[model samples]
Structures are given as C-alpha cells and as structure tokens.
Target: MARVERDPTGDVCPAFEQPEFQAVRDSMKPNPPGEPRSEEEVLRMLRDSWKAGHDKRVEDWNMQVQRDREERERLEREQEQQDEEQAERPEGEGQKIEEDNGKKTKKVYFDENIAVGDTITDRPASYTLNKLKLIEYIELFYFTPDGCRKAQKESRSTASTETWGITQMEGEVVGLQPISALKLSKFVKPDTELSWEEVMLGRHAMIQEMMKLGDEVWPVKVVEAFNTMYAALDAHPMRRQEHGSEATVKYQAHVRREWYDRQARKQGFNIGVINETLLRSMRDEIIDKKKTESLREVSVQGFQKNLYSFRLPNPYPSILSE
Candidate 1:
C-alpha cells in the first residue's frame, strides 16, 4: 500500500498518511449485504442530475419561443394579404364603400322620367264630395250677419262651428269674401252616369297637389269651405250694408283680417302680415278654384309674389310688371 504523509497544516493527506489510507480502504470495503452510497457521493450525483434537468428546461423554453415567433410571422403575412385584396377591389362592388368613421353610405337611384315644373291635378265626388260641399256651404253661410249669429248658436252644439268660427256670420263673411269666389266644379251632369272611384281618385290627386303647394296657396279645403258657406248665405238674403261705403269697406277689411288670424290659429301657423301684392298675384289662380288646374301653378305665383314683396330689398321692376 502507499505510505501516508503528514502536511504542515497538521492534517493527514490521504495519499501520504497511513491512517487516512486505512480509513479510505475501510470505506471502500464491500458490505455483507447491500448498502447505501456515501453522503459526499450521493450529494455529487444529485448536483449532476439537477444540472442536466436545468439544461433540458432551458432548451424546451427556447423551442417554445421559436414556435411562437413563427406563428406571429405567419399571421402578419395573412393580414397583409387580406389588406392588399381589399385595396384591389373596385367601388360599389359586393364590398360597400365605408366612410373613415366606418359608416356605409347609401346609394340613391333617381327616376329617369320625373322632371321639374311638372303639374298634377284631381277631382272629387259622392259622400266625400258631399261632406266637403257641406263644409263649404257652412263657410259661405257664416259670412253673413244673420248666418254668423246662427253659426255661433249652432257652434255651441257642434265641433265644426267651433273650428271654423262660423258662429259670427257677418265676421266670417267679411273675412272670407276676398277668396269667396273660389269653387269646386261639378263632377257629374244632372242625368249622366259617372264612376265614384274616378271622382275619388281625382279628389285625392287634387288634395296631394294642394298639400304639395304648402303655405304658398290657401289650402284648397279651406277655400272650398269658404265658397260653400258663401253659397248658403246667398240663398238666404240678409240685411245688406251700402255697397261702397268707406265705413262698410273698412269694417269688411277689419273682419277679413280677424278671420285670417282665426284661420292661421286653426292651422297652427304663425300670424304674419299678409303681403298685399302677393295676395293680388295669387288672386286669379285661387279665385277660380278649378279642380282641373294644378295647385303648383298657383303656388309658384304666390311664392314669387311673396318673395318679391317681402324678402327682396329692391325687387326687379319686371317681376312686379309680370
């Protein structure tokens, strides 16, 4: 066996000291049966195994990071392709145009035949015609003094009188007289056959045209009522004032203004000063109240008159001359 030696530190070196060698020899000797490893050896083996496990975990983590990077690159390429495809598409295709704010704009289609300045007309008949006729007659009756008093008395029992201010017959008459000449023409002859449907259709068309005219012309319905009332009053004679007296005319004007104010209230309109020139321009068109003519013509005339009369600081003389 190799001789063991003592070092200056006062500890025996295993290679040189006999006692230390003997201890090593004893430790290496085989046991009678199986035995566990020495503490130092077991600790060394555990440290080596832990180092191997640590290296494997680092490799797995690097592999996962690489896979994620590859997936991210693939997604980026796909997104780029989709963007290019969308950009290549034409407008108004299956894909709609979107505003920057992401709202889709609607496509509007216009009818080829519809043009500006076209006129439409209509007529009326039967129960509908009868009802309108009755209202018109009542309006006419309310224009006379006796009619006005009767209307006021009747109004207490009827909603129509209240709505129309027909109770004050003289007042209604004075107010509505300027436009009283307006009338709806007859739809049928004394013994002639006629279709109610045709009459109704005509009436519907007339109403639509009137509505389209809006405030430009007095409502056709009101005009009809005024005419009807006047006719009724004409059938029954009432006390008459001197035809051209200043007082009588002045009173008529005042009543007319009052009636107009009342009408404005009923129609939920602002009571503005009536433009005299515009009223004169519309006079002929409205006065006739022919169902055959388009309300648009009357409206255009009225609008031009009002515009020239009220809005323009100095309208061209030609407009007034026309």
Candidate 2:
C-alpha cells in the first residue's frame, strides 16, 4: 500500500481534510508526509472519485425524470377539459352536431318530407292505432279533467292504461304531427295540471312546428279541419270578447264557408251543398283577379322607377280568355 498523504498541518490526511478534490483540483501536493504515493493507493483514489461522480449523476437524472412526468400529467388533464366543452354546445338553432374521429362538426338541420304514398302510424290511444294514417287530429274546448275524459271517452275507443292516455291540449288539430314528438302529445303524470294559456299556446306552437317539418302542401281536409277548430275556439262564449274584428282576426276567420254549410245541411236546414264544380270555378276567378291586380301594381311601380320599357304580356292567356 502507498503511504497516506497528509495536509501541511501533518496531523490529518488530505483526503479527510479541507474541500473534496477532483484530479484537476488536487493542486496542494504539500510535502506528502515525506513519501510519494504508491501505484496501489493512486489507483484506489482514482476509483473512489469515479464512484462519487457516478452516484451524483444518477441522483440528478432521477429528479429530472420526476419533473418531466408531472408536466405530462398536467397537459393531459387540460386536454380532457377542452374536449368535454366541444362535445356539448349545441351551437345554434336548426344546427345539428355530428362527431367523428374524436372531433365534432355542426350542420344545418332541414325537415325530412313525408310523401302521400309513404306509410305512417298514428297512435292517439291504445286501441286507436291508425295504421292507415287516415284520421288526422282532433280539437276540443276543454280544461276540466272530466271535460278531457268525456271528450276522449266519447271519442276514445278504450280505457286509459299505464302506457296510454292523453295529455295534449285538446285544441283543433289538423295533422297530429309532421313527425315531431309533443310533450303536449302524450299522457303524463296525472298530477300535472296546465293553465288555459299553456294548453292553447302549446297547440299553436306545435302547428307552426309542423310547417317546418317539410309539409309544403297541407292536405285540403286537414286545412279545413284546422279552420273549423280555430273558428270554434275563437268564437267560444268564454273567449276574450273585447277583441275587435282586427285584420288579423278577419284573415284567420274560417275561409272554408262549407263548414257552416255542411253543418247546416246535417241539421236538416234546407241549403244545397255548394257544388264542388262551381266552388272550383269561383275560386279560380278569385285567384285570377288577385293575380291580375298584383301584376298591374308591379307594372305601375316598375313604370314609376323607369324600369319597365313596355307592358309585359299576360303569362296565363288561357285562364284569362273567355
């Protein structure tokens, strides 16, 4: 073994005293305690230095790895929160959400049209499943539980069951739905009560909804049914009587005069059924007159603006001809 090297003070070994040293920092060779270090001791000192630095390096690397792991976890949590918000927001009216490949997309919604030949199901009550889709909808001026009950019973084919009954406002109905579900459409908890305005307003809101459901051409009979019911409700003895005959009221007044004519005939009042042929002729004449007047107004406006160089020919000469 090499002899131990001491500090200048002589009582202490340099390795145990003062600051720890690297090969480059070992400048204070002192008198070395009066002997040079042996090859065995020199090699041992070098190995000891290598072990100390190696241990320190391992500890530093472990601390850096722990910090990296924490950063990654924080980023993952933030990303999850962002994804949740995008998945829920409905965006806009008439807009639909579609998702694909962990992403979301929004598109405008349009109603799907149902053709006359297409098959449909109408289940107003348990027994009355109009598989034929023949009967459209019904309306009644009722708010009483028994009013609803008796109206439905006289009209209903069966008893109310757990899964079946009625809950919608019994207003005049044209077509029950254009394929939309109504909270006003189905039976609900018996305890739920509704106000007069709520009942009538719900029906009106649903009628507007049906128009948006791709129903461009409403069936004639359905239109007539709506006209009949709206008139009945409007003229009800309990209606807000102070309402004046405003243009709005006049416009909605039952245009189908046949309703009263038919009712009168059924009651044995002597009046002929308006001939369908003559009715068609009269309707055509009214429509033709309106068109002519509309065209003349447009021409007058165009002339005033100097946009019309001459009068345009009538597009429907055959209809205008005697």
Put down candidate 1 lDDT per residue, 108-162, tens digits, no spaces: 9898997866653222222223323322221222222333344334434443432
Which candidate gets the maximum lDDT versus the true structure? 2
How well does candidate 2 score on lDDT at residue 264? Answer: 41
Give the clashing pairs for model 2: 139-171, 182-185
Per-model tally of clashing residue pairs: 22, 2
How much does each candidate deviate from the true structure in C-alpha RMSD?
34.2, 28.9
TM-score, cand. 1 vs. native: 0.20
lDDT to native, each model? 0.40, 0.41
Model 1, global lDDT: 0.40
Which regions of candidate 1 deviate over 4 angstroms? 1-33, 92-322
